[model samples]
Target: MRHRPATYLEAEEVRAILARPNPATVEGGRDYALLLFLYNTGARVSEAADLCWSDLQLTAPRLVCLHGKGRKDRLLPLWRDTVAALHRLRMNAQPDRQPHVFLNRRGEALSRDGIAYILRRHVQGATQALPTLDRKRITPHVLRHSCAVALLQSGTDITVIRDYLGHASIATTGRYLSTNLQTKRDALETFWQHAGIRPVRAKAWKPTPNLLAFLDSL
Candidate 1:
């Protein structure tokens, strides 16, 4: 079978992973939380890794991405659970680095590759423990796909998902839409049902002189 991206992690799997004792420390756990946050949010690895403290605001429960693909900036809303994870992370974070949202042990910003490495390790650990998910490998980008798929699966609008993911084109976000087989079937059934009920009838009456006059006037 062809290897494809892991679109969604079943709710039970998600629970299992989250239920596991976080193996990383205060700083490291914060990084891990941020990684999960990014994965859950469908944020680009770079955008999440370079995020600053000021970029996140609890008021709107959102994060402002400064540098996105094509150097564009966009605002991303956080899910309630994602926000909770962030709060927990911030509480244990070191005081030396109040600037960066994700900091290394040295209190410096984490590199994009560093974040990817963290995700790789985390997935490896999570999969090793969960033998049931051995065939379903996860990665940073896969997490991104999972976020989009989760939204699409939950009956979210495709345009909204596109905007949330900061996608420049709707086509870029369509991949997530493809995984929603139930949504597609529902749409097709609705279309056929509506088509069956709506009868196409031709106009039987001839145009009156007044109608002709109106058309002439126009």
Candidate 2:
């Protein structure tokens, strides 16, 4: 059996991927917006594709994630741009549009692989440019990692990232933070600044009887 490849995208690679022009056809802008949404929210491919029109608060600034892994549910705030993108997609959709957030050319929901293919089409070139990325293949999971890393770089707490990603363990979400060099450097320096060093001393002073008696009286 073929093993699933690891997914992680660096900050610069995500920027390059997002910089591409949206396709001129069906669900193009919405798809591009989905990529940005995942990069910002760290949502899984299925989670983003499974999102429903009703899942979003059309008149508000938030979205509900109902189809998370294990049927777990959560709410993720949407940026104005992300909300606008969803609006565009919703406007273009047919009157009896399906609930799925992402649709194929036939107006059917996109599978996980379909979403992966969409992302790869835009990200392959960007991935190839990176000297560290030898595979030249990019996927939705990479966008998820990019989101987590970006948040960590911005000083988001580990516990928060864990909650946002809906991880069962904080350790799972912690791996993303480990790749952020700047965060690690800042953490190290902060620790050094607050840690005062003292030499081991030979003094073993004991309280005098008079001092003890005075203390007892007080």
Best by lDDT: 2
Candidate 1 ranges with C-alpha deviation above 4 Å? 1-8, 21-25, 60-63, 92-98, 169-218
Candidate 1 lDDT over 148-193, as tens digits, reads 5445444566656555666643232545534433343343233223
lDDT of 2 at 164: 63
lDDT of 1 at 148: 56
Across 1-218, the per-residue lDDT of candidate 2 in tens digits comes to 33333345555556567656364545578676777677656688878778777777756535544457766665555555566777777777763658777888888888898888877776665555554555555667766655554444444565555566666422324455344323433432332222201112222323344423322221
Please, what is the whole-model Cα lDDT of each candidate in the order they appear?
0.55, 0.58
| Top-scoring candidate (TM-score) | 2
Q: Which 10 residues in a row give candidate 2 its minimum summed lDDT? A: 191-200
* Candidate 2 Cα errors over 4 Å, as ranges: 1-7, 23-25, 125-136, 168-218
